[model samples]
Target chain A: METPNPNIKMWQGNVACAEGALAAGCRFFAGYPITPSSEIAEVLSLRLPKLGGNFIQMEDEIAAMGATIGASLGGVKAMTATSGPGFSLKQENIGFAAMAEIPCVVVNVQRGGPSTGLPTHAAQGDVMQARWGTHGDHPIIALAPGSVRETYDMTVKAFNLAEKYRTPVILLSDEIVGHLTEKVEVPPIESLGLTDRKKPTVPPEQYRPYEMDSSDIPPMANFGEGYRYHVTGLAHDETGFPTNNPEKIQAQLERLNRKIERYRDEIVEVEVQYTEDAEILVISFGSTARSVRRAVINAREQGIKAGLLRLKTIWPFPGKEIEAISASVRKIIVAEMNLGQLAHEVEWATRRSKPVVRINKINGEPITPNEIFNAIIRQD
Target chain B: MDYLYYLRQDKMPHIWCDGCGHGIILKSILRCVDKLGWDKNDIALVSGIGCSSRTPGYVDFNTLHTTHGRALAFATGLKIANPKLHVIVVSGDGDATAIGGNHFIHAARRNIDITMIIYNNYIYGMTGGQVSPTTPAHKKASTAPYGNPDEPFDISRLAQAAGATYVARSTVYHVGKMDNYIGNALQKTGFSVVEILTPCPTSYGRRNKEGNGVDMMRYQKENTIGIEKAKNMSAEALAGKIVTGVFVDKEQESYLNRYNEVIKKAQSGV
Candidate 1:
């Protein structure tokens, strides 16, 4: 006896992500075409113009990323989407965004990698790349969505975090989730609570772009807003100019990490299901989490104690969450579509305390529920 | 015009070596902006990595010093997202033609409203004078000790071929002409490129025995050919001569204007 929601519709993961970005006040998108994530650019190309937003297909992924950062500094939310190879091409600009503290979102629809391993396939190979891809000790925010609806929600959350932290956030979607179809009820655009970067409250002449306050994040003034300032990829001081002084360099580098580390509680997110008395724990993420849920349910039905811990935020890695839940669970299993990418992290998070087993697949396919369920039933 | 009004005096003395013509090209830009009466806040001086890339930091505009060879890419986004802002890109021969060649041609093909100042100093002055794409054949650079093997690029011609609405070239020796060309490029409403043949005397001139900065400026005065005079010259006569004049200037649909039409059409839902 429930009323049918008129907004409910069948949406693909990539489509939902595009709609999510629109709903979250993302007005600029510059991207190149690649499999699995191409729909994001296609949908935005048609939708953004109608919404008075900007959408452009740049010359390549490097330009796409560069534009995304530029558009963000131009005082609008911007994003770009690509597969594995394109993602690699975007790293230098991504590092630029990190160093300059520009607010933008980068979507990496995970395909198999290490030089185009599989284009139209599911793989979590770029998980580490998403964290350390940009060749520096800068902070990052990356979220992996497990299903169609979560893709939409996480896409919104990704933008919010980007604005909140003044850093680029990665919407890490795999080919499986990106292509999957499921029911989604999109909230009205006005109803969606979106976050914008904090604007400078001081007079334009007195504004400093990187002057950190008590909140650790400085107000970002838009370009052409009368607050003329400098932004550089080099190590810069609070005034936002390139500086090579050792003391100033150390302070600026520390402040970049401090801004995110101080607020890790607000940034990290995860989901735990049925772990009250479970003896076996399954750690999973992205599309693999969808299959792991099914296997966990089957393991319970077969009278084995099994529960699921799904990672929503991939970096800053939720290591504390694993350690907190380690006391009760005797063993932990990581299931994914790559050859032990997150498994390595799970082992480290547990600090060699649990018997961590990995169920990895590198083929152009999703990890099957049977494969994970069989792992749960087997002892040795 | 008072130069200090546009410059961030606190950031100077600048890192440019004595007699390096980057300062000359920088003055031309400042003069052009002053003549136009454009608000400093409304201009974004974006640059990629090079000695010329440091031009943004010296000015009181919304400056962005980006990575190597990606200034055009960044400026494209800044302009498209906010059409009200005037985006100018400052790059060098290596930054513009070598590492940034792909973006250069594509930005021209799109015909976006960005004024590019290509300071063709013939070598990588910031990274210790490696041979750049514009380094003349048989020129001595640090990497080209036995003389450069690459033919130089005619930047103004390249811009004309790549669909730029305005293209011009001048050398630091011709300061008045450089300012005139920079002013004309700034007034245009499409992709405009002004290639300035400047000297990197400390690295490039010292290696090639071009004498000092004064000697290099004297060479530019002697070797370059004005476009009008070159009309009657034979191919062999113009082969080694640096042609300095307007190559292309015309009206065309800029990328922003065309994209605005797309937005209007999309809103109409026809």
Candidate 2:
């Protein structure tokens, strides 16, 4: 008298992330164990070695990021996952990858923090820190997903963007997304398009490590391929040598910054719902987007015309789309776990006195749908 | 021949001041690597931000130019990802032993297979000749124009005490000996540091009235005693003397070797 349910399955967001990384050709995972992100490292530690991939639990977050960069150089798609305090500990190495232009994925399943705010609770306080935590001026590609399915999809995309741009791409998940259990289909690895970093086509003797021919990304070659190039944080010339020449420094700096800026349209990918004729708009990312979606539905039932702009890509700020929406919408409400982080960007993008309301709760807790609805109602 | 052929020459001639000892130390490093005949692909170079940390740009290798005081962290990652590659780090005194002092000690304690080459110019050269942890006491620098009030770091001692498997010190003036010491350190199985006492001729030299690169080299030549002699000397006798030689050489399993043991033990279902 027992019947198995064909459509039912159980998997946590962390497992989905691990499986998605495997699907994305991630043969190397270097991460220290931390919660709620620890499940990712735990599953990866078990699964990676079985598949002939490398999984190393480094001593700390710094070493974790460093190992991922190293494995990427060895021609493997590599990634590392961590939570709040670990993410803060990893900024220096993440910035290193940014400056060196190493292609890799860093998954930060954010918990509350200025410093270790919440280890187990869910919060999105790292929204601003993800963009500006690293020292110096550099571009970052960050993705946030509200659901387990999106975590898998976005983790794959994060790898692709990193490879395409030759920069570190961050997957900004919160504890809610990383630990929430849901059914996810693991696609056959070959069905997905995985990107390996571009190696120089020229002979090792003729290669220029950081010189771009036409594409924004310069051709790169890994170690043991015989090609060699230096990487430095200092402003350098096309050949990647350190320079003090103001003109060369300026050119290098601009190139580093603009390589991502010029491709903003291609870089930014967002999900918009009911925004065409909306008077009030809700902007949110990560797990907060789920609450915003619920709030949008609640606002509609209350006879208020509300829409949701769920940021799938959180960096390069999506200025054009945000600007376009701000011009047409009467009010913009930003819902996040931190006070006035993405709200600052919204204000900057709108330029005008756009009445942008912030629904922030940073006591290691997520903002509920009621909070988002109230914030919108207050603005209304 | 352009000795720096592998260097990103197009980005040069370079930003180092005239008569700076960094150029000389860099040359020695490249020469050692070349002479060893190791494939450039098998070598990984990492550096933190500073005047000497810029050395990674001149060598064609798998390279990472990381944040200030964190080259050790990046190099540790590189070594862990593929322990087969020879990982080396080039850091400034400030970058390696000051701001990044915590990472440096931990790497040594863990005995990771990384070679750290510290360019000790006694001052922060790139940031304009400020006093550094390696700056001798009472020495005048841009930040300490009146005289450095802080005690100087005996870097080799600190590293050895931190559990580094191999540690050595050499000056830019001793190019031949430096190449030998550096080569041996690179060949060592675990964490090693070669504290290259280079001269910041433009800043440190000018401030201290050492005349130029030549004068700085002469000062080093006269002040340094061999490690054997240093071992027998009293603190008063060794007061103005710099010791140049290998201080620690021992065998211990590196990070990777220990990790492999864990993997092996796990595979056996233990």
Query: CAPRI band of model 2?
Result: acceptable
Instruction: Please provide TM-scores, in order, for all candidate models, with all chains considered together.
Output: 0.98, 0.86
Chain A TM-scores, all candidates? 0.97, 0.94
Give me the overall lDDT of model 2: 0.83
Which portions of model 1 miss their true places by more than 4 Å? A1-5
lDDT of 1 by residue, A117-170 (tens): 788888998898898988979999999999899999999999999998999999
CAPRI-style docking class of model 1 based on DockQ: high
TM-score of 1: 0.98
Best by TM-score: 1
**What is the iRMSD of the candidate numbered 2?**
2.6
Question: Which has the greatest DockQ?
Answer: 1
